[model samples]
Structure formats: C-alpha cells, structure tokens
Target: MSRKAHSFLHEYPRIRVDRFTESRERVPDFLLPPRCRAGAAKRQDEDEDDDEPGPWDDLDQDDESTLKANGGVRFFPAPTIQLLSHIHADHIEGLSAPLRSSAPIYCSAATKEMLMRLESQKSREKGACRVPMGEGARKRPYEWLRVTAKHAKAKKKFTGLAPAPRDLLHALPFNTPTELRYSPGVNIRITLLDANHMSGSTMFLIEGHRGAVLHMGDCRAETWWIEA
Candidate 1:
C-alpha cells in the first residue's frame, strides 16, 4: 500500500505527488542519483542497460515537474529560506540547485543528521542557477544516466555521499517559534510542528505581517497536527 497521508492538508505542501512508498529507501536496489559530477559521453554499448533504477527510478513523475504544474517551489524565485521536512527523494527533486545556491536550508535536527546519507550536493553546474533544474521529470541531461556502483568507482570524481555544509543547514526546534529577520522590514516567524509522519516529518507554521500559513510537507495525519 502507498504511505498514509495527511490527505486533508491542502495548504502549502512542498511535495504534492502521492507516493508509492513511504520513503526513498523502500525502492529496492536503490542506486546512486542518476547524475554525474561532470558530463560524460553517451553509453557506448548498444546492449548496455540504461534503464537501471536509480534513487528516483521508481517515481513516475518528479517533484519539480509537479511543482512546475502546481506553481510553487520550482517556479518561484529563491525563497526567504529553504525548509526540508524529510530526506525522501520525492521531496528533494531539483534539490541540487538549491544546495548549490547561497540560500540557507532549515529543518529539524533529525533531517540534518540524515542529509549526510543523501547524495552530495557538489556538482558540475556553475554560477547562480545558470541552468534551471526540473527541466526533466527524470534526471536532467547533465544529471543523466544512473550512477551504478561500478560506474561510480570507474568515474573517479563521483562521490555519491558527502557532508552538507554546516553553514547552509539550519536546525530548528519543534513547537518553539523562531524569527527570521530577512531585512529591517521583512520579518517572518516560523514554528515547526510535528506532523507525526516520520522521525523528522514536520509542518511549517509561517507567520508574517499579513497572515499565517501552514506548509504541510508530505505527512500522514488528520488532526493532531493543529494541536502541535
């Protein structure tokens, strides 16, 4: 069965796609991301299996494409801050671009701990988003072809996993509110509430001068979220 969801939540959800599995780990034989640190020539052997499953292989549509259709993260310019609810691959499509940018990323402490387990953000793309991500539902052409263990070892520069930069990741406390002073006039109060979806799953309660908006990033609950 697919993972349970906070189906009623229609507010600001980061990832809107309904998933086939609870998390990225459920995909069997999950290979490294279908990306290379540098561009490579297309596969030489005609018989070579280019369809090998990568981390997001199981996903039919990608988050960025969904974002493009739904009109959110991918289309909007750099947000005030980046917030990650969890480390699931679906929630992280088009992730490399944000990681490469200077925008700070915020999440619960658990999410930060797990970022190390994800593919390293170091990549070949240059300058501030010279090429936009989410151009393809699957891997971008530059992020083309799955990086198998054999391919990774053969390609000396491909290190699938590495430590996220400390300065870029921000861990916020659940329940307690934190203030983001973007400018003298632009300030926002953000509070993280437990979504009870997973170890670090959360919903964002963002309050500004105009109003309060709750962003429920992929979650699976009905009511207790408001109590948080």
Candidate 2:
C-alpha cells in the first residue's frame, strides 16, 4: 500500500500513502476462485490459452455508468495504469484480475525478480499455504518471505490473499521519468523503453494530461530502438 516516493528513493519523500485507495473500480472480473490451484473447472483449459485480448477483457456496464456520471471527461481514461511488458508466458496470461488491483504494477527489476520468483512458486503449490523459513539473524543471506496463511487471514473460506509479490511492484529504471498519480484525473508520465522483446522487456512511454502513448511492448529491432 505504499511506494510512490521519488527523489531516487531516499532523503525523505514517502511521507504518505501507507494505504492508497481512490476507488480504481476496475471490474471485468477474471474469476479464478474455486479454491484455486487453477481449479475453477468450467473455463475450458483457459480458453485455449488465449493471449490476443487487451483492455482489461470486458467492461461496458453502460460504459461504466457513463464514466461514473461523466468524470472520465471524454475519450480514454478509466483504467489507470498497469504496464508489465515482460515476464512472458504470453505476457502473463490474463493476469488473474490485474494481479488483484490497487494498481501500480510497472516492471523491470528483472521483472521484479521474476515476480518474486513467481510468488515463491505459488507458495510451493499451496496446500493451504505455509512457507515458514527463517533464521538469518547475525549472518543474513536470505530473508524476504511472506507466503503466509496456514489459514489465510482467519479464513473466510478464502478468496485470494496469498500473493505478496512485493505489494504493487513498481520497479521501472530502464529509461527513467516516473510519476503516476493515480487519481485527480489520473496524471501520467511513465517511461520504460528498452523493449528488445525479452528478459525484462519494456516499451511504454506514455505522457500526461491524456495525450501521448507509445506502448510497443513486443519489439525486436534495436539501435536505440531505431533512434527512439
């Protein structure tokens, strides 16, 4: 729920946002909960493993109630930000519902350490999840661990609360420029070139006040991206 301070991370800047919530309201539910481990049944082998679908799958609830009574003020807006141009497997097929919202998932610190090692290998194939491993006290070489929930949050019959992939994972460093104020009319300013189309690939260049966008996520040619 935190992590939006710039100043190159230090000397003071994250004075707030320990809990960000501005109603990102993005619901085109990619349902995945029938006691997961890919169980939900009916999906037909995940629709033949499709990948050619973008724009959050589906949504047109009266066009989001007319952009929530007209604040999306025209054109394209309400889908704040989520640019993960690497970690292929057909680019993370249907990202389970944008990896469970609170959106802010840029990428590339080796794709956030390969999404924290694929959430610790889905917590060792969950058997109700429990990855208890510690002891680095005076000689630390391994520490970050959180695949918790022997009974996931006091169990309400659980519905997906075991992925702590470094919270909303924002890494972006390839090109620089990074301000992403999620609300107040969604100010942008992303930048992540270097999409040689592989290891930690990236491409988005997006600018501000609903203006520019370069999203070429699957590139190949080089030479500084053909002189950018």
Candidate 3:
C-alpha cells in the first residue's frame, strides 16, 4: 500500500485515471481549529465542567466523510464528487453516495430550493423519475470525496495496481461560497462557478498540482456586450 501525503510537503504520487493509487494525507494540524476559537472562551468555560466532549475531540480522528457532513471542512482526495445542479440521472448518477450523517451538500441556495421543488413535483405526479413538462428536475448539490480502494484482484508482477470502486465522502451545504470550506494544506481546491443555463446551475473549477481543470455542468455561456 502507498503512504499518506504529508501537509504542505508533497509526497503522495499524483492520482489520475491512469495513475497509481495511494492513501490519503493526514489533515494538517494548523488548520484543524476554526477561526472563531478565541470568542468561544465563555462557551468553553461552560463546557469545561460538562461531561460531553468538545468538537476537537471528533476532529482529531481525521475522518473526511464525517467532517464534511457535520461541518464544511474535510481533507479529500482527487476526483471529488461535485453535484452541479438538479438534473437527470445522467448528470447525477455517477456522483458519490451519502457519507456520515448531517453532512452539508454544497450548492447554491437556489439549487437547494429547486431540488426540494423537484422532489415535491415527483411525489405529486407519482412520477417514477423525471417527468415530461417538468421544469428543472435538478436535485440538491453536494460535494463528495472519492477515496481509493484495492481492486478485486491484483497481478504479482506489476508494481502498479488498479483501484476498486471509489469510496465516497459526501458533503452537502445549504448555501454556496461562504458555506464552502476545506481542510488546509491539501493540494486540491474546489470552487463552484455559476452555470447560467438553469436557475441553479453551477460549474466547478478544480485546482491542484496536476493543473487547473474547469468542468462545465450544463452551462450555457452568455455573450455580454460592452459599449464604451
């Protein structure tokens, strides 16, 4: 098995469709605590005597799936699952499955609303799936992490091995940008872009050591006219 990547120190081999697979890196220590820690002193004082554990206790374990759900931060891998907007199965089918409960599924606030509306319409029409004449059958948007796993079988002679079906860590956020956050020191950064094609459509800009990649999700680019 490959080793974990260290924080701010590149070690893990690049992950690609045709590249070798490796374990995820540890969440960097510096970025573990929230920025508002100092203001919570009184809250901390009250909790000091309580029997219940604190947030950091949960964070120390370094579970990406859990972190994304409860909070918006996580140390994820490449090929993170990004749900752009509510659409048909072809658009959402291959995305990640649910992870630890209560995770934030990232999307524009409008997209979230659109999904609920779609669900309701589905129930009313008793539609098995997307129905004709239905508007914006888009569902909620969420960010997910895809972890690597070993393939069913491996050949003895090769140093490189194939990975099995990806393990997903789902993160669903009710809002966008501000609600969006990530664990520090990771090579990957995901940013959501507006996909003007639909009411709540979005595009994703993924940046990493490999390079910057822009993925368009049902986007209809607009041509703006400037008169000067």
Runs off by more than 4 Å, candidate 2: 1-105, 108-110, 113-115, 118-166, 170-181, 187-194, 210-221, 224-228
Tens digits of per-residue lDDT for model 1, 44-108: 55333445433232233336556456432222122335667776766554444423345456788
Error of 2 at 85 (Å): 9.5
| Candidate 3 or 2, higher lDDT | 2
lDDT preference between candidates 1 and 2, better one: 1
Q: Please, what are the lDDT tens digits per residue for candidate 3 over residues 1-228?
A: 012323122212221211112334444434334432322233444533344433233233535466556353444244222343544443443233444323224456565554434443344464654355433333323222332343223322243644444423233333233323333444455566666767666665556544565555566665651111
Clashing pairs in 1: none
For residues 16-96, could you state the per-residue lDDT of candidate 2 as single tens digits?
Answer: 111222333322123212222122334545553344433322222236456457543222223345557776555544343
TM-score of 1: 0.45
Native-referenced Cα lDDT, model 2 = 0.47
lDDT: worst 10-residue window of model 2: 7-16
TM-score of each: 0.45, 0.26, 0.35
The TM-score-based order of candidates, best leading, equals: 1, 3, 2
Cα displacement (angstroms), candidate 1, residue 44, comes to: 63
